[model samples]
Target: MAEKEKQEDYRVEIGGDDSKRSYTPAPAPSVSNSPTMAILSYCGASILMTLTNKYVLSGYDFNLNFMLLAIQNIICVVAIQGAKSMGSISYRDFKMDEARKWFPISLLLISMIYTGSKAIQYLSVPVYTIFKNLTIILIAYGEVLWFGGSVSRLTLFSFGLMVLSSVVAAWADINAAISSYGHDASETATALSTLNAGYIWMLVNCLSSAAYVLGMRKRIKLTNFKDFDTMFYNNLLSIPVILLCSLFLEDWSSANIDRNFPSAQRNNLIIAIIFSGLSSVFISYTSAWCVRVASSTTYSMVGALNKLPIALSGLIFFDAPVTFPSVSAIAIGFVSGLVYAMAKVKQQKVATTSLPVSSASSASMRDGLKN
Candidate 1:
């Protein structure tokens, strides 16, 4: 998930029919076209978080996905409170009104993470990484309709390539998996399933994740939430709902507990859960920061773009098939990301740079009219 926070001080100028507002950057010395550092921060934290999640879920011994989420939320809340006490970061104490407002977004986040865990349990990491790019289209158009954002033609072309890459990756993954059952016609027929359970969960995850990001982006601006506030509220408000689900949906017997946290791997599991929680603070902050400083589409694009390394790493570490078609698909994604980034930079530069000239002209005309 992502949110927009612009790096430069900018204002919306209302003009034209029906009071349509335009999002143009104000004339400022530090009118950066993009939040390069925030993008980097998100990429780093997001990748670390994803890899660790995959590691913990890879074995599927942990049956309770929501329980795991609850643990992480608990740790993150504790860490944030500790940091607040230490004066490292500060946010408004939990207000009922604000929590009421933020609760829907938290639910969306829970749906996204839970569905993602379900999907990732069955899908290869590389396929999951590539398919995530599909959310960019939804976000770009969502921004256009709801946030007064626009997508350039170059960006559209890049989107097409991204879609193609996902198709290729999915096809290659299925083919490689099916090849393992060669020389058996019955098995081949049975294994020809494309829309499996994992893919269904992945689709749900994509929709939920997109909704969460878009909703959070709009809500944060409306509420004037700082990054820390978003981080705190999302993690904090989610615990009760998650625990409630865990209560109903998960096993709590001592035998199940031992199975979930076996004695030998218990140390590793504890550390991973703690690390995931610690990193959530960073990931949440960076995600909100990126969306605020950048457009929602740009935030989504940059996150997917940065996944070039993630796709490759998933392939390397997860031992997914290293086929020619899969490699080419990754290459296509990389090139499209470059094209999209360049186009966004050019668009922002023109929009921001032209504002000063237009503002100056308006000012001069007003002075002449006064005289």
Candidate 2:
């Protein structure tokens, strides 16, 4: 009798049934956090936009950039719907019903307009293109300082490389201006201006973009919204903000609508419009997705990839002179930026894998005992 009782007790402990017991597996991590594919799309979009702007829209004046942005946002809406129909995840799960969620989106749209306009106005095409890398450095430091996270040494090295590459890429332009305009002439004085008026605008762009990323991260974590939902809301909020800014700041009454262009120019403008629109959609979506999957530092470094192609295209299309020093700088920057991005990815992967699973098993045992 005693032996039988002991056996029964052992069975109860193992099976958790005699008194009560149960088993429950922990919920798996959501797939939404893995956004590598999205990051690639963002990088691709950057390259496409650079190509179009350089080769196709050189002489067009139909507000092609604005038109492309509008079209891209529309396409983003369509893409979200498509994602939903395919039974992929969406933002509906977040349960957010407040109007306040749209604020950050509006800020982003305003920043884009201001930055784009200012870049065209004050900086040479090459300078504007190269300075964009500054955004990466700003974002990386912002994340570390504001979020209380430490940046890895590899990441810092990568940022240094990117900054170096950017300076090198602009070297050819700087040298040419010095040679043609004479190193000490007043007429050429503006050409040698470093971080001129337009650069200030780009700095604003960097800060606004950082705000968007940081704000959106907080919002998503709090609400548990899907990527598509966040994107949709952001785009929707941007429309009115863009329109309002255009009305007050831009000279809408003097807007030109003529399509007059040489046959070749017209063809190029058409190509630019299509490519720009596609790129806008790709970059906007992928960037947000990247922030969700990886740290801001990683995303920022990935953004620097645009400089390589942009610099090369400037040389090929505009006959921008390339020098040995400039070339070396570009190579160094690209390698460093790549290294930083790889390190970030490794860190994110480790973080995901480190999640505890034992708690779920304990909960299951307790439930079984209660039953």
Candidate 3:
């Protein structure tokens, strides 16, 4: 315990003091209180998961979004259970009461993932990356309304830049699509129609993502769930919801299976699916941990910073065009992220400096009560 305190003391100097924050989303368990570690882990997992999911959903004939989600959830549960049996991880066993409380977030998770997949299907990764910045805006205001947290003016300015980046990205995506296709005027409007669908889905994804983050933060307080427990409940509850969607909503006919899982691509799809499922366990856990140790808005900002590598990966693997407008937008978005981080650092310093005055007032109140 002395050693742990010394480690935490050293981290306080390096990572800023979490206890000094005006409002904490929830009390973080000691094991997962290192905000820096949580943020870095989450960013890595998030980037990998996004690229892998994109690869899986990239198949032109793939239309089994619900089925794919169900498989991922199943794999998460299996992986966690296997790890538990091996004594590699520690988390509480299944409890009906906890599951009941966590079920709503599971529904939100379904919407977030389903809409995300639908959007990425119709959009390029670069366009998708820029549009996701909109979620940070939503989550920032959400933290204000729900957690009594305040957004600094600098942060708000950064938000404006993020919005500009998205608009520029959308404009560039459209122009590039039309010009690069080299289609004659006689061609139909297929590309435009697809892009329009993607935009609609992106809006829904942003909304669902904000709600999921806020909802999970609130639920964490009520459930007293650690990151591992939250992840366990999320994947476990999602399995049934996704399975239900796959059963009634999705076509399960033999013909559809062959179309979605073509013989030539079957083995590759399986491999990707397995890898995605395994990685999801870490992604979900680290996400919950980041939200626990830091605010949802900060978690969102880390996501913003994470897009640089993501955009590069998208270009390398997915053939997303590297155009001037796209590069400019990525640069603007990256700058916005840096500005927001600076804003947060300033905000924390102010909070920490005021703590002594609050402590003094509390001491006086205690003395008065004793009298």
Q: TM-score of each candidate?
A: 0.78, 0.66, 0.81
- Tens-place lDDT per residue, model 1, 197-279, is 77888889878776777777767767777767777888899999999999998999999989988999989987987787777
Better of 1 and 2 by TM-score: 1
Give candidate 1 misplaced runs (Cα > 4 Å). Answer: 1-41, 183-195, 285-302, 354-371
The digit string of per-residue lDDT tens for model 3 on 1-371 reads 99666556544232356645332233455656889898888778877888888888876467889998999999999988898899977889999988888899889889998999999888888789888878877877877776666777888998999899999988888887788664654232677778899999999999988788778767777988766776778889999889999999999999999988889889999999888887788776676667668764466457557877777777788978788998898888788878866776576567668753222111111111110
Show pairs that collide, candidate 3: none
Poorest stretch of ten by lDDT in candidate 3: 362-371
> Sorted by TM-score, highest first, which candidate order results?
3, 1, 2
The residue-by-residue lDDT of candidate 2 on 94-113, one tens digit each, is: 23463376566557655665
Question: If both were scored by TM-score, which would come out higher, candidate 1 or candidate 3?
Answer: 3
lDDT of 2 at 104: 63
Stretches of model 3 off by over 4 angstroms after superposition: 1-42, 185-188, 285-301, 355-371
Runs in model 2 with CA error above 4 Å?
Answer: 1-43, 53-68, 78-96, 120-130, 169-172, 183-195, 253-255, 259-271, 284-307, 345-371
For model 3, state the Cα shift of residue 290 in Å.
Answer: 6.9
